[model samples]
Target: MPSSTSRRTVIKTGAVFLALGVTSCTGVPAPSPSSPSTSTPSAGDGPSAAFTFGTASQPLGLDPALSSDVESYRITRQILEGLVGVDQTTGKPTPLLATEWTESDEGRSYTFKLRSGVIFHDGTPFNADAVCANFNRWFAFPAALRQQAPGSSFKGVFKAHSDEASLSIFKSCTAVSADTVRIDLTQRFTAFLQALTLPAFAMASPAALAAGTADVLNQVRGGQPLSAFATNPVGTGPFSLGTWDDASVTLVSNKDYWGERGQIATINFLTYDHPQTRLQALLDGKIDGFDAVTVGNFDQLVKRGMQIVQRDPFSVMYVGINQEVPVLQDVKVRQAIEMAIDKDTLIRKFFIDNTAQASQFVPPKISGFNNEAPSLGHDPAKAKTYLEESGYNGEELKFYYPLNATRPYLPTPEKVYAEISRQLTAVGLNIKPVPVDWSDGYLQKVQSPGDHALHLLGWNGAYADADNFVGPLFGEKNGEFGYQDPQVFSKINRARSMPQGQERDEQYHTINVQIAASVPAVPIAFPISALALSDRVANYPASPVLNEVFTKVQLKP
Candidate 1:
């Protein structure tokens, strides 16, 4: 995550466009398009008083363990704190609830020294025992429960790979002392630290757990949250829940906060599913800020004198190809589809300013982005040749996409899909659009084998690591996207085990290059994301990780 100083540097250089080579992806010289520029508020400007933010969607729930989508994550971070936090500038693990930690036994064991004098929002003491209890509960959550509630994104990282003992890497969490907890792993997993930063690993109040707040079994069977957990979340952050419902979420400041208290007394996150409505709310001064600003509205917002903060590229919009489907199973067919779409034209036609066409899975800031990787060019003739070689006989590929959900990476899903569908048909492949409401587990359906042939999805780095992208998308054979390429899988594993250095980076580069050749998915673009703020808002934290902290935010008098 970039700090305020570095963020300002990026703004001055228009680095979002330069870093990803946004305009140069096609290897064809085209006139440079105008991109979104950034500026720092002089502290004398922006909204005054409590911050009220409107978003395009609502969180499924506030429990960190049960929320996976970005809307949920944005709210969850305010209510929970993990054992580890991220350094704003470096995007590396730093101490949070846990003051310090040490690794031993060749990285198989980790002991964390908990910060003292901390208490949950419910007034329960936070101790090593609480940490152990939270860990045990996560490990004990039924795998069946995970299927019913796809929000448990931690399943990929925590659940055993197989029934075989050796295949699983998780061991146990034990309280070594009143202020220390030790976690044991079955192996030396290099991405363990990165994994800890995920919301699933966040520490919740043990008292709430004891009260049966997170009833995973009941939640799985009934599709209803245990009201205690859902309605009244308990965490050790700088805010406590004020009110929560489907329409709006309100958080009040924690006056007795252990860390610095937030400047604003309250934050109201109102759900505005319509992009235009949400933007209008900000424009009309009904709200102070919002994210996922409507496309083609930057100039309008700038004209309105709004304070816009654009993040450096840290996400990838892509098409997920399910290999289990017959036609898609053909590597040539997959490559043909990948080569058919013109990403450059799509960006210009549909995307907002500064979004770059992606050639590989991870973004430029991530460790493994290969500058020398081959670009998947838009060539209709080449696409046709590949389709002919594969002997595809006009089978209708079920191309699934979501409706009513606007994400930072894929803001206009329907339009983007339409463009891609048009390109695929022009290349002689039959295309069928299967549109579903995004809230109806659209992403899960695509990731599930045989349910989809081609689907549109995207990822913003959960933590600023390459492993965060590869491990979730392609680690296990049954991982997300259901993409099975033996060479790609093997190379990814080899890359995951190596430490962060030249050797690890080289291995990752090799793996990315291999994935491109495999055509498991079409890497679309690294989107330039922004947040709209009112004139009187100041020090509104702009995080590269998109995990904005609200404690330091201020409002003019």
Candidate 2:
């Protein structure tokens, strides 16, 4: 997922501001003036049993391996199953397709016992061979394809760089028998099991793969305009793809699902980029609920009797500086950029009460979070001093921000960018604000190396492990920041290889502090993720790892 930095985007216009109560983006009211009716639920003629929610961004496609954004993951989770599932309440790996597993070869190999008597939606048996096939396909994804298409977000989890001292822990996956699969790792990686819990590693139907439809990721990378799998997807989960269009995507319950059938017959996600429009829709009862809810409208939504569910802060919203940029190459300049913004003020102006200012990339709950890292002071004088110390010439710093999608951490990106731009300007920096469409162009550009000078990005955790935070963005050279710190990389590798405990946590904490001092990105704030639901909705599913299982959700009347 765009870090919740890979998670998503959001926007602006004078008329939009006016509808949002004429308040600035940071202070704007979320709901439209027109109030929704407080009608009671009736047995008949009430809302459909189908649960309808809104997505702030449209998913790129339904192919899990090809998808890299939170929106795509949202849909993917409903349609697919990973070998391991996350326990929502405890944030630990739970059983899924693979009922149990054993670690051997000194933590270098894992043997999984597949769940028996399961079939894909297409009637093909799911077995050890299917698991191997999926692994083979992932391993075979051409390196060149990463450049052509939005590459697989799970690439790092599966493979390691050849040139670096880093060893590829994933050596091979083999089917030892019909009910068992053995995976050999080149080395021990403590986070390997946790990484398997990501949706990107979810087990897709091998029948779909054999039938040629599951090759959407590969085909799109070769320059196909669009992939068929995006609209028509086949999976063994509790829900199957129903209808997919530009406006909405629907999922119908899988009656023949291996596990308990979904209580709700249908799961519909309406694509609404604008927060006000989504809020109005909720108020009018046109939809049941929505995610990435605007905090500014929380009171109004509560007054309207909407049920609000919140997750502890798990994502980090930050200002990513491209180190390759000439102006940002100097450490002093990067530190100066970090000092320019007043994160406390921004958090107070935009986020919910629970949201806390961040000093490191990882949130407080993560094992490796550096609680003692010194927070950068909001000192324009010091910022100017650093700029002068760098002996820098005034250059137009291209500041990029996404325009039409919002994540839990970044509810109002345009407003956030405006404030950030204002802060930078006050520090005597030449900044050029560039707004790009969230899907049309923003994501690809920001994730590509050297395409940005400075960008506003956030990352929602896919798993609870510290590796989830440090490995993706800084393990090697990441596309977003283009940062390549050898010390940071070494520590990340060492931490991942060690078993989960205080020792491992200490290693990660050390790494985070070193990273904080390096200033790869300005750690901003960890915003609390929230969901708004209508009264009829019940047993709503959510996880700090961002997992939401639809099978358990129910609707009243």
Candidate 3:
């Protein structure tokens, strides 16, 4: 998985923000402080006790470097500390593990000064050496790490240099001094500092790593022995891993945490298989907080005195067309798929105002978004004409969607697939829905070109840059769904090479326009992030990157 930091950087470059000219009552409201009173008792009014939270899905994996799933990252954020952290007031990058850092004249090298007296969860010393080891391990397993979706950029950031005298490559990085360490990159990158804040780059203790007898600190691969320390992670963050059940997890206070201590001594993370079950848990007080609230139950939750935190997520949900498939290879056929489905109706009826009808591939929250680009409007007559002109004669089209991974903000993959099937049938195309498990289905069927003709997937802007929106989805090496567009590849390369300014923005605009014309993927909707919190948890900040820092979270008691 690409780090949240990288995602933000990509959005800034590729998916520039649009004005969102459409006026609707169902948009993101201004941020407000948590309500002080509700039917739920305040922490101070009751006993000072532990609080438990719940989610609709389980974490994909625990090892930070190997797993890129959102739920896993959320848990790791509590157990890990990065070199830099988001500012409490502004939510921008600030110094964390590294007190300060300075760049060289060419921006290729960085020297960091580690904070003093910081310790990992197991009481191991945290210093420059620990930082070096963590990064070295990640660089070693680049191929394995890159297998996770959106993690390909890790290779672009770090490079290893060999000593000619010994003629041997160095796997472990050396600390320059007690508090200082130097990192040499292959090329000058503008977002190097921001990338250091990613969970994949977080430092781990050498002691635990050695005791586990693992080559790397946190490795998650098939057939490899599980790291003993993963079940009880030790880091310099506010909370330490306590107990982990299949359906839930618990974290205890790290008494020696370098930052502000959490007001609550214990925090629990519970999981439910379905959205309805999660909402029921929240209403019955079985869980204190939950996210991605179902649209069907949004009204009931509000009536029950639950506080909903609504924000536009950086992700854009869409349908990916297999370019290798003969039927979809025709530009007119791709355009037919784009025009047949009704985005506005899907958003209004299925999502019920929780989603924005996406006009382009990128969402509006990203910076430098091109608002003037033309959107493919819903026109069934035109779609039918195009299908006839393109020589498509009711060919059977295979559409694959993950069965188990349905979120409330967006229409269920099955529902969207069914709608597409119905719409395309009107245009004289036979569509088949192939539903598979969320775990292996995405990688095996949708990502592989040999499996299906069409697949449903989503892209959450890794960085705020346009490069993020353009590069991964269109780059030649992007194996995800086997999409390889040479023109798109050239445009992304040009945009990346250009300096940060108007010139780069223009290059990205051209990329977006070209992508819209090619129609590799049909934009569906931009979903909103909906979260509910109990009155006891205070100062819970909202972030599009999903980097929830527990240091500032306070219990009312």
> Model 2 Cα displacement at 245 (Å)?
0.9
Kindly list the per-residue Cα lDDT of model 1 for residues 13-76, writing each as its tens digit.
2244223321111111111112111122333433234779987776766777866778878887
Poorly placed runs, candidate 2 (over 4 Å): 1-48, 159-166, 213-226
Which candidate has the highest lDDT of all? 2
- Candidate lDDT scores, in order, read 0.73, 0.74, 0.62
State the lDDT of candidate 2 residue by residue for 1-557, as single tens digits. Answer: 01232122211111221122111111111222122311222334222357888889787777777766788889989888988776555555556787777788878888887878777878788899989988877766665556544547645674452332255667788999998999888878777777888888888777776565554444442122244554566667878888877788898877666666645778899988988888888888989889887766565665675677776677899899998886787899998998889988898787866589888987776666777977667888999999999956788899999888788879989999999999999998899998987876576788887558999888887877778877887888877887878877888877878875679879988888888888989979988777888877865766666788776577674
Q: TM-score each candidate.
A: 0.88, 0.88, 0.81
**TM-score of predicted model 2?**
0.88
lDDT of 1 at 397: 82
lDDT agreement of model 2 with the native: 0.74
Task: Kindly list the per-residue Cα lDDT of model 3 for residues 1-557, writing each as its tens digit.
Answer: 22334223211111111222111111122122122210223334332357777765565555565454566677888888877664433434456787667766465567777777788988889988898877766665534324433332343333222322131112335598877787865445444554555676667777776676433335443222235555555677777888886677888877776655646678788877566787888888788778676566566765676666655556777878887777777899999988998887766655634367776766665544678666778999998889889968777888887765655334366666677778767777788878776554354356544648777777665344555566556755444445667777766655654555677767777777888888888878877656777766654655655666655566665
Clashes of 2: 15
Kindly report which residue stretches of model 1 are placed more than 4 angstroms away from their true locations once superposed: 1-49, 158-165, 217-228
